[model samples]
Target: MCRWLAYSGTPVLLENILYRPRHSLIDQSLHAKMGVETTNGDGFGVGWYGTSGTAKDTPAVVREIGPAWSNRNLREIAGHVRSHLFFAHIRASTGSAVQQTNCHPFRHGRWMWMHNGAVADFQRVRRDLVLAVDPDLFLHVEGSTDSEVMFYLALTYGLADDPPGAVARMAGLVERVGHEHGIEYPLQMTVAVTDGLRLWSFRYSSQGASRSLFYSTRVETLRSLHPDLDFLREASDDTRLIVSEPLGDLPGVWNEVPESTYGVVQPEGDAMFSFAPALPA
Candidate 1:
């Protein structure tokens, strides 16, 4: 439905991830190889935890209602901004308006979120799901897209304290509500989120076939695998990227995020585990 990526690593110009790769996020906006849509041009957004002296708790986000590939402001911003953690997303609206508020990398306090799939028959479940969001948090829901609703639901369910758990609960609620509305496959998503520190990503769907997702292999291992790649040599051992698809054909550099699984990236290392929807306790 859409394509997005999360970067948690040493600080570098945003363009290094958004524009430099053979199939950079910018490239994917126009020529995505794995997304449901070949082109994701409805809108785009980037949210980054800026270096010290800038915003440290919540990320500073820049979003536009135009196609990312042709946005001069986005191009300039990518070149000038750098961060240790960031998210970039290109939208292909399932049904939402193509407006800035509908762009991804949605921010709320210290957390930021983006997704690459839809809550099936969203309009049917919209009322139920929206009514479930905590009123205080619901006030911050600025867009009509299911993606934004999902974000707020996660927050309402406990994202600030338990990301993976909260997301599972959010998915549980979506499926629960969708089933009531007669939707069989209530959800399909490859999602990424961060709190300006650790990053959490998930791949899951009610029907068992979720959107595709991948995370880069260990940085040190990649360096040993391809000594000629200058980028790997300069990257920190902890650097990692989770994307909707393999950024390129680098054989040993990317690992598919197993279906129905979630992973976390932090300063210590990365961890992966099974993911399943459960009603919030």
Candidate 2:
């Protein structure tokens, strides 16, 4: 289990989301309120797309296996770097080795992926799922966590062509394989994926009890509600965030993503839609 946040909007200093908020991601790294564990200090990582033309050319990432709050370099970099699309994750390893390679916000070329839940009976189904990954993509897997395997699986199934469909298929594959091994609740996840332009997040589980996920209300709307808040004034109208939990106690500023649903955030628009496990072919 882990805690993560995805930001898509006007480029702003990373600190605004990582530290400025009353209950920021760094705070969650040590005081997560809704995660299975209170402190997700196993490791942390951040991925962002720079000002370069496309994601491949401007990709920048910083990760370490130390507590995020104690990392001076992380604090310095976060305060200066800026990006319109970014992801930050604080981890709490679930059977995975605590190493830099095992941190979340895993990247592959122009895409980035992170998850906040575990696959039920991962060991039992790991073989089946790993074998399903394309060998070319399989070679890139440098870690042993189910999360990394899940990302490659999505790529194998065409994540670049259709993210939502690819993820739906990936989830279906995991469910199918897990069931064959007699595991009842095959998946539990609050996942975030980005391609430098658009962001997609999902909250779902095979058993219907998904972990918490939320998205912030539009900055414009919030400005009207809390006209005196200085932070709201500085943020862009489209500034939005999707997190494992609300970052602060701003009443009505955060909305729970419905059970079995996924959300898409883009510079043009945003929407939340129903999601269900895809049936195996």
Candidate 3:
């Protein structure tokens, strides 16, 4: 339903990750090779943490109800802003209105979240899902998209303290509610979330087949394989990118995230875990 990318590494201008790649997120907006739709022009957003002259914990976000490919504002921002961690998304409405509020990479405090799939029959169970959000956080639901609802649900379930557990609970609730509504295969998602210092990504769907998700091969390894590429040469060993699709065709530069799994990228190290929905208690 959508395409998204999350980058964490040496501080670099946004264009390096959002525009300069061979198959950038901007290119995916119009010619997505793996998304269900070829065009994700409904809307787009970019969220990044500021490194200097301002708060470093809370991110600055910009969104628009327009295609990223031709959005001069996005291009301009990409040219100048530098971040060590950031998220960018291009949307293809599964039915939601094409509005700025419905864009991906929704944010709250020091956290940001984005998704690439839909909640099956979302409109049928929207109220039930929305009601599950904490009343205090529910007030922040500015958009009517299922992705945004999913974010608040995770937050309500303790995403700040336990992201993986919180998300599993969120997905579990969606499936439980969907089944109660008589909908089968009630969830589909490849989600990314971060609190500036670390990022977590997951791929899962109730019916088994889920959206595409890939993580970049380590820069240290890629450098030994393709030292001629300046990008890898300049990148740090800890740099990481998790995306809905490979950004380029560089050999040994990407690996598919296994089915039913979640991962985290951080300075200490990175890891993958078997993931499953745990019915919320």
lDDT of 3 by residue, 1-281 (tens): 99999999888999988998999999999999999999999999999997742335898899999899999999899999999889999999999999989997899999999999999999999999999999999999998999999999999999999999999999999999999999999999999999988899999999989999999998889989998988777788999999999999988999999999999997689999999998888
Best by the lDDT measure: 3
lDDT of 2 by residue, 94-208 (tens): 8989999999888898899999999998989999999999999998999989999999998988889888888898999999999899999899999999888789999999989
**lDDT of each prediction vs. the true structure?**
0.90, 0.89, 0.93
Task: Work out how many backbone clashes candidate 3 has.
Answer: 0
> What is the descending lDDT order?
3, 1, 2
Candidate 3 ranges beyond 4 A from true positions: 52-56
Clashes of 1: 0
- Candidate that beats the other on lDDT, 1 or 2, i.e. the better one: 1
Relative to the unseen true structure, what is the C-alpha lDDT of residue 51 in candidate 3, on a scale of 0 to 100?
72
Best by TM-score: 3
Better of 2 and 3 by lDDT: 3
Count clashes in each candidate, considering only residues at least 3 apart in sequence or on different chains: 0, 0, 0
Give the winner by lDDT: 1 or 3: 3
